[model samples]
Target: MHRYANPSRFIRIADTIFPWAGGIMITAFAIGLYLALLKSPADYQQSEMVRIMYIHVPAAWMALFTYAFMALSSAAVLIWKHPIALLSAKAAAPIGASFTVICLATGSLWGKPMWGTWWVWDARLTSVLILLFLYLGYIALINAFDETERGGKAASLLALVGAVNLPIIKYSVDWWNTLHQPASVFRLDGPAIHPDMLWPLIIMAIAFKMFLLTTLVTRIKSELIAARVQNVQRSLHGNLADGRG
Candidate 1:
């Protein structure tokens, strides 16, 4: 991992992976959407409305997964002082937040017909909302300071501290009486969902993962290039000031 601390090396690796990630993401989305929308049978109870789960569940899972990834990156930044760690965490924040927003919106759309309400203060919903706020807060904090390093350090601390919410979000239905259903897709016994539904969900989840990887790499590369340019400008200005003096 320390070998990747060099931005140039990291970008080289990312460049190699980017096209593969994009291709896989596109293919998986095509197949997953076909299975989800056209092939899978509608729910006996919810009917066509269950289709929303195809998008909502995957987004929710990615939201959690992205945050976990970001938190680990932030930890690397703090503990190992890995040069690319902060960039990875920073790049991941908005993506995670966007997933969180999609999850909330699609969940609300699903809930309206089933729960007779678009919004609820359920344990699961509330915890997920908090997760969104944490993402936003982290993004804001990281840009709040003029010194990027200082801001990143502060935001990394917040990311680490906010990790406590992950478990709460996962087990909210189990820990409390919430309108949200308990785990059906992931169980100690096995997934309770039928294979027909499960396969599409899993494939969609893969597509989401690929999307994250592709976007994260792109964002990290941009950050590295911008930082290099800024450094060059600073050095040029400093040399000019020295000549004048």
Candidate 2:
């Protein structure tokens, strides 16, 4: 991992993954949407409205997955001091936040019709909301310092601390009586959903995962290039100061 920390090498690897990720994401989304929107049967209970799960569930999954990825990256930065780890965490924050917003918004939309409200302070809902705040807070804390290293370290530490919330969010539906349904898609016995709906949901999840890969690679490369340019600018300024003296 440290060997690939070289910006040029990492960019080369990213270039390879970018096109492939984009292609898979597009293809998966096309199939996933076709099945989810047109082919799958309407739920007996929620009817056509349950189709929203195709989007909402995948977004919710990605929200949690992205945060877990960030937490792991933060751990790398703090323990092994992986040069690219902080950059990866920084790159992922906004994407994860976007997923969280989608989850919350879709949940509210689904809730209004199903649960008779636009919002609720239920355990799962509240925990996921806190996850959004964690992402936003991490972003704010990182930018608060002029020194990038200091900011990254501080944010990394915050990410580590915030990780405790992940498990809480995952189990909130079971841990307490919440309006949210308990695990159905991922259960020890097996998925509770029928095959017609399950297939589309799985494909949509693949699309979302590919989307993350594509965006993360692009953002990390951008971060590396920006850092390189900043280094060059600082060097030039230092040289000018010495020449003047």
Candidate 3:
């Protein structure tokens, strides 16, 4: 596993996995959307408005998952000094931020119909909004320094620290009387959702994971290429200076 930390080796592996993951993502998305939008029954309570769950729930799940990935990569950077750790962690920020925005936007959309308001400072929603801010902060901090290593280290540390918020986001509803629904599908006893609706939601969840993987690998590839270009240009400039001296 550690051997794959070599950037060249990692890129080689990413190249091979990229296409298969992308194809799977597309297929899963098509099927999931069919089930979510067409086959699934409307909620007895929320009626057609429940369809928003397909998008909103998945976005929220992926947002949490991506941040967890970043936190783990940050741990690898700080503890093992893993070569690809910072890059992988850095690459995840924008993607995570995008999903967080989706979660917030969709939640607001859902709220207007269900809760009669477009916005609220409820525990779960507020925490998730904070998650968005955290992602933005991480992106900004990563690009704040002149040196890549310095910026990477600072961003890595921030990721680790921000992980504390994840649990807060997850349990905020349970711990408080928030308008946000508690865990229905992930309960310890069993899923509260019916099999008919549950299947599409599960498939959509898988689709979101596949999509995140596809984007993450592509972003990391770009980061690696940019690093190589910077190194080559520095070497060329140093050689030309030596010749002039």
The regions of model 2 sitting more than 4 angstroms off are: none
Q: Give each prediction's root-mean-square deviation over alpha carbons.
A: 0.9, 0.9, 1.0
User: What RMSD value applies to candidate 3?
Assistant: 1.0
Question: Candidate 2, TM-score vs. the true structure?
Answer: 0.98
Candidate 3 structure quality by residue, lDDT tens digits, 1-245: 48868889889988998999999999999999999999999999999988889989999999999999999999999898886888898998899999999999999999998999999899999999999998999999989986668888888888999999999999998999998989998889999998888988998999999999999999999888888999999999999999999
Between prediction 1 and prediction 3, which has the larger lDDT?
1
Give one clash count per candidate, in the order shown: 0, 0, 0
lDDT of 1 by residue, 1-245 (tens): 87778888888999999999999999999999999999999998899898899999999999999999999999998998787899899999999999999999999999989999999999999999999999999999999987679898899999999999999999998999999999898789999898989999999999999999999999999999988999999999999999999
Question: Per-model C-alpha lDDT, please?
Answer: 0.94, 0.95, 0.91
Superposed by TM-score, candidate 2 places the C-alpha of residue 136 at a distance from the truth, in angstroms, of: 0.3
Among residues 3 or more apart in sequence or in different chains, the pairs in candidate 2 whose N, CA or C atoms overlap within 3 Å are: none
Backbone clashes counted, model 2: 0
lDDT of 2 by residue, 55-170 (tens): 99999999999999999999999998887998999999999999999999999999998999999999999999999999999999888987567898889999999999999999
